[model samples]
Target: MNSVTKARYDGLADWYDDRFVTGAEPHQPGLLELLGEGSGPCLDIGCGTGRNFETIRASGREVVGLDYSSDQLRLARTRTDGPLMVGDAAALPFPDESFDTVMVMWVSTDVDDFGAVVREAARVLRPGGVFVEYGVHPCFNGPHVVYNEDGGRTAHPTYRQSGWHEPAPWWGEDGIRRQIGMSHVPLADYLNAFLTAGLTVQRFIEPEGPPVPHSLAVRATKPA
Candidate 1:
């Protein structure tokens, strides 16, 4: 995990889910279904506000939500009675092969060295376990792209990582302004991270939603 990312998320922790997780967010249900209501521990990396913890518990599995933000974890503590730790994604505090499944949702694109975090995910999952994630689509989000005429539009090259990152501003109806900050990792860079972590790519999908065309979703596995 990048130190900068940790700082930003920590600042946004308390209100993170409120701003992002709504009924219509893409990939939440799809990722949950892939987990299959299993009977094992689930590790949610970057578990902002513990939004997924309830769903994980409803499936009869123990849940551990880890994030680097005290503010966010404070809110998460209120949502579910589970272990919430402040930890780095690149160097998780847990041992290898500890979880049956690991979830990295919307956090991959926010790291500096994504491969480090992916490697950590692989190290902590049991054999045959699944690692699933959803992140910004690198295709539309690539660098070298320029926002044309504003209002959620941009142009970019066909490559990833090298693409520019231009996040939109946040101004709530309460007349307060929230700053826009972001981190970028191209699509290919993300896929390679999983491979380097000794995980096998099972599936990748571009989830459909509004405000944008697609969000990338992936399911990978560690061989038993």
Candidate 2:
């Protein structure tokens, strides 16, 4: 992400905790189940309001929430007693193999360098440690589609296009674009990033079930 994007998040930081996050995220059930118990520290990458911290902690692990926005970190501090750090996900400020579990939730859509973030996750995770990803379903959730009046999505030609997207006719006021530009990564790229980083997939979960699942949660582990 660029300085512009960071500025946008900082601008929304004050209201962010309330405006966007109402409660525990939708993918929590699948995410927690896949991540399983952790005896050591679990890094929460792009951990906006630290909503996932409680769940990670519940699984017998120390939680560390990391985000690039300082304002987000300030809000997160109130939610999580765990250490909150202002850091970039692309170039995480930690040594290699520093965590027992590296968990990312609701992040890839906002950041431009998705691959770098995945690589960083793999780098920090110890061998046999899990990398759990919980976020928008890449296949169906992209800049190319919008939820229709019938509760289904209407596909836009721009679906295959990947990169930063400004809020437009397809996604205006009520969407994330109203806050900051979003990055649309294809499904292949999403999985390939983990594979290239030397992590092997253990489980792939879709929280929304069938007929257009809005979210996905995946668990992969670094080879021991």
Candidate 3:
């Protein structure tokens, strides 16, 4: 991730809730429900503003939140009563099998080293521990870009591989903004990454929750 993008989010920390976290549009609740309750330490990767900390901790599990943005960490501290670390998802500062469960919710694609992050998540998880994540639907959700005036209605690319090469488009209620995101990885990449990392596939769901044509939820377990 670029320092400028990190800084931009850092600057938006105070108002991130309004800009993005007001509701469950990202489906954190459904992911949590799928994870159920586990009696072990939990590591939340890219835990911006600790939005999911309370729910994860409510299951009587010790929670540790990590994010790369300092400004976002500040907001997380205010919202959560758990340990917080200003750290990178690709380079987690913990020992092997340090956590009982690792959760990466809706933030993997945003990361540059998506594979490394997944590997690190598996490394920190204990034997038989679960690793869960939710990400944008690469199939139906295309990169949408909205330019000022001339850049009128934008369309999400129908295909993932080809579309990723093109610049992503975005149009918020506020105005037109250009977004640069990662390549649209296929479902196989997500599955193979965990399997290659030594985590056994437990569940894979492509939720059809209306308005969201495609959203993925994956749960894998490290073999004992």
Candidate 3's residue-wise lDDT over 1-224, tens digit each? 23534754677665776666666454454676657778867898888887777678766677789888888888888877778988878788999999988988666455655677889899999998888877765454434422334423334443445313444334344421233234445556666767778888878877656443446878888899
Candidate 1 C-alpha error for residue 27, in Å: 7.8
TM-score of 2: 0.93
Question: Tens-digit lDDT track for model 2 on 117-186?
Answer: 8998999999989899898888777676687766688777776777776576767675576667677888
TM values, all candidates:
0.81, 0.93, 0.80
Cα lDDT, model 1, residue 192 = 85
The candidate that achieves the highest TM-score relative to the unseen native structure: 2
lDDT (10s digit) by residue, model 1, range 143-166: 333334443656444344342255
Please say which candidate is ahead in TM-score: 1 or 2. 2
* Candidate 1 displacement at residue 47 in angstroms: 0.3
Q: Model 3 Cα displacement at 115 (Å)?
A: 1.1
lDDT of each: 0.70, 0.80, 0.68
- Between the candidate structures 1 and 3, which one is better when assessed by TM-score? 1
When sorted by lDDT, best at the front, the candidate numbers are 2, 1, 3
Single out the weakest 10-residue window by summed lDDT for candidate 1. Answer: 169-178
For candidate 3, the per-residue lDDT at 215 reads: 64
Report the lDDT of model 3 for residue 185. 55
